[model samples]
Structure formats: C-alpha cells, structure tokens
Target: MSEPLVSIRSANLFTPNGTRIWKDLNWDLFPSEIHALIGESGSGKTTLAYSLFGLLGESWKYDFLHWDVLGYDLSYWSGPFGEELRGRSIFLVPQNPNLAFHPYRKIKDQVIDFFRLGLRSSEDPKEILELWKEMGITRPEEKWNSYANGLSGGEKQRICLSLALLGDYRILVLDEPTTGLDANTEKWVLRAIRKKSEEGKLGVIFISHDLRIVESMASRITIMKEGSAIESFPVKDRKIEPTTEYGKELEKARRFFL
Candidate 1:
C-alpha cells in the first residue's frame, strides 16, 4: 500500500462568533487517488475545501487542527510557508469562478497572473491554450481574450480547471466543479481529472453533490454535514453501507457501493 500523502485527525474549527464549524474531522489522502467529499449545500464542504489549502481566514479558530503531509509535520501552516504551500502543493478550484478572477480581466491574463503567483512553472500562452482545448473550451483564441463575465458558467469552470491543471500541485481541491456543465462536458472534465490523477500522481479532494460521479471517481468517500465528517469508507471495501448516521442517510439517499 502507498503511504498517505496528507492526514487530518481530530481537527476542530469554530467561527469567530464561537459557533462551531466542524468537530473531530478526520481524513486521509494517498497519492493518485480521488477523495470525494459529498454533502448538501451549507454543509461546510466548501469550508473544508478552503481549509485544506490553508485559505480559511482568521475569522475561524481551530481547537486542535493539524495536518501531516508527505511525512512532514506542518502546524496548521499559519505563516508565509503555509501560503506558499497552498499554491505550490495544494491548488483550489473554488466553487465560484467569480471569486477566482477579476470580472473585467481576460482569461489569458488571469491564467498568466495565476501562473506567476502559483507554481511559477511556465507562462507560455501556447501551453495555456492547449489546456483550454483539452478541457473542451472551444475556440481557444476567442475564449482566451474574453472577460470572465462574457463566458458562461460552464466555460468559466473549465477555464478554472484548465488553469489549475497547469500547475504541478500535489493536491487539487475542486468544489462542485462540474455544476452547470452538460453531461458530455462533465464526462470529459471527469476524464481529464482521472488522467491527471493517474498520470501526474496527483491527489484530489473532489467535492460534489452527484453521488454517481462520486461512486465512479472516488477511491474513498467522506460524508460531511453541517461542518462535520460523519462517515468515511473505501470504495474498494467489502462493506456495503456506511456505519454512521449521515453515512446511513447517504446510503439510503443514493445507490452507492457496487
């Protein structure tokens, strides 16, 4: 068995107003695996996505949050190192494309800016255009020069995914990335993701509401609700249903597990 790339154990967080956001959350990710995080909206799935990249602002306090990545003990990464690691090691494709770039800026410029700040790997527009084409963003030339507001929701998402893929980040955090995408487009996107994970040895935290997609892609599943992880099980496990309340709920809600 491969060693885990990242591990979170007994982590707790709270809002600034002292409202508990999550309690005793535990998860593990191994290389070349997809960890699907599924939950209803407002269930803190997005918050967990941000937390993985150390992007959660100071408005939230941690009771005892710690993460171990690649056998290194990173203590919540509250400093410059954490911020750097956020881009270099963990890339986040936010739920809202509106938050990823300036509305007036061209997609090319946004990708350039992200390339500069993140990974610092390359700035070739050709490579960027290739990624755009690969993600099924048609007419790369037109899409590249278009402003964020001009593109539809699905286009914006694929563009975001393309930009994230340009980097060599170890873990890619995608929050509801396939929303608003048509079935064929969504399948293409998922196929691209699978290729990245298998060929690049990348670990992904794929957050989605679609149980079918999760069943197909996730090597393991984590059930979250109202900020807490209630159930976790491996797809390869012989067990049929999750043992926790939320897990059982999910079991009843979706025809999971083959």
Candidate 2:
C-alpha cells in the first residue's frame, strides 16, 4: 500500500479562549484520492483545514499526538517549516473566492508574480492560459487582463484553483468549492475538479456539507460531528453506508431530501 499524503492521530484543537472545539480527530489522505469531510456548519471542518497549515495563528492551541503531512512532522506547525509548507506543499481554497485575490490587481500580473516569486520559475503565458482553459474558463486571454472584480464568483473560484495548481502543492484543500454557484456552473466546476484529481498528481481534501457532491466526487469519506471524526470509510462503488449513528443520521438526512 502507498503511504498516506497526510496523517493525524489523537488531534485536538482549542479556541483562543481555551475552549475545546475539536477532539480526538484522526484522519488520513492518500495521493490521487479525494477525501471528503462532510458535516454541518460549525463542525470544525474548516478549522481542521486551517490547522493543517497553521493558519489559525498563535492564539489557537492544538494538541496532536502524531501529525504528519507531506513527509514532515507538523506537530509544531507555526515555525519556519510551516512557512515553507504553505502554498508549497498544501494550497487551501477558502470558502470565499474573493479572499484569494486583490480586486485592484490584474489577474495576468498576479499569476506572473506568483510563478516568479513563489516558484522562482519562468512562467509561460501560454501555460497560464492553458491552465485556465482546463479550469473551464472561457476566453482565457481576455479574462487574463481583467481585474478580479470583473470575474464572476465561479470564475474567481476557478481562477483560485488554477493558481493553486500552478504552485508546487501535493494536497488541495477546498472549502465548499461549489457553494453559491448555479447548477450549470457547479457542474463544470465539479467536472474540472474531478478531472484534476483523476489525473493522479495530488490528493484533494474536499470539505463540504453537501453529501451529494461528496458522493459524486470523493473516493473516500470521513464523517465529522461536533469536532470529532466519528467515522471514516471508503466510498465503495460511489455508495456510502455509515456504521455510526451520527453518520447514519447524516445519510438519512441526505436521502430524505432525495
């Protein structure tokens, strides 16, 4: 069996006020697999994503017995190694796509700067255009020169994903990628993500409350509730049958709407 891209055991996260929010969470992600984190709002799914890269800053506290990602020990994730990990090994797509860009900066300039500064590689304009095309962006040349504010939410989301792909990342953490998108837009966005994951270049950590999307995209699933990963299983033949009560309840809720 291949080694997991990410692994955690006996992990806990506390709020700034020292209130325990996440407890005894254990999870694993493998390369070329889409592992979905499904739960309700305030379930600490987003916090788990943020904590992976130490984005919570020094205020929040984490107690992890074993935390490893991309072959590095992230038990103390706020140090120099953590700085090296962000945008390099793991790229997080925020719930709000607007947070990924500056409204005033041209998309073309920002992309070029990223390749130059972040990767230290000479970026080909054609490569950028091609990447956007793969993300379902129409008329990449025209949109390239446009400001972030000019793009629609779906477009910005795709743009953020394209930028992340350009980085040297092994894992992509998306917090609700299809949220607020029209049905058609959501379809293409999901298609693009699926295509990328199927390419087997990296692993994806897809965090969403939408079980339908999770069932459609993820090869493995982890059910989280009240800050704990209560159950984890492979999505055999695209079917999810949870063994835990909370997980069964979530599946029941999903089926009720269907």
The Cα RMSD in angstroms, rounded to one decimal, for candidate 2 relative to the true structure is 2.5
Candidate 2 similarity to native, TM-score: 0.88
Specify the highest-lDDT model's number: 2
lDDT value for model 1: 0.78
* Candidate achieving the largest TM-score: 2
Clashing pairs in 1: none
Per-residue lDDT over 82-105 for candidate 2, one digit per residue giving the tens place of the 0 to 100 score: 776564567777899988888888
lDDT of 1 by residue, 1-258 (tens): 788888878888888899888888887888998888887777778787676555677777876566777555545465677876676777778788778879877878878878778665668888888877777788989988989888888788888787666777788888888877778878877888888899988999888877778777888888888888888788864233578876778767775421
In model 2, pairs of residues that clash are none
Worst window of 10 by summed lDDT in candidate 1:
70-79
TM-score of each: 0.87, 0.88
56 in model 1: Cα distance from truth in Å?
1.6
lDDT of each: 0.78, 0.81
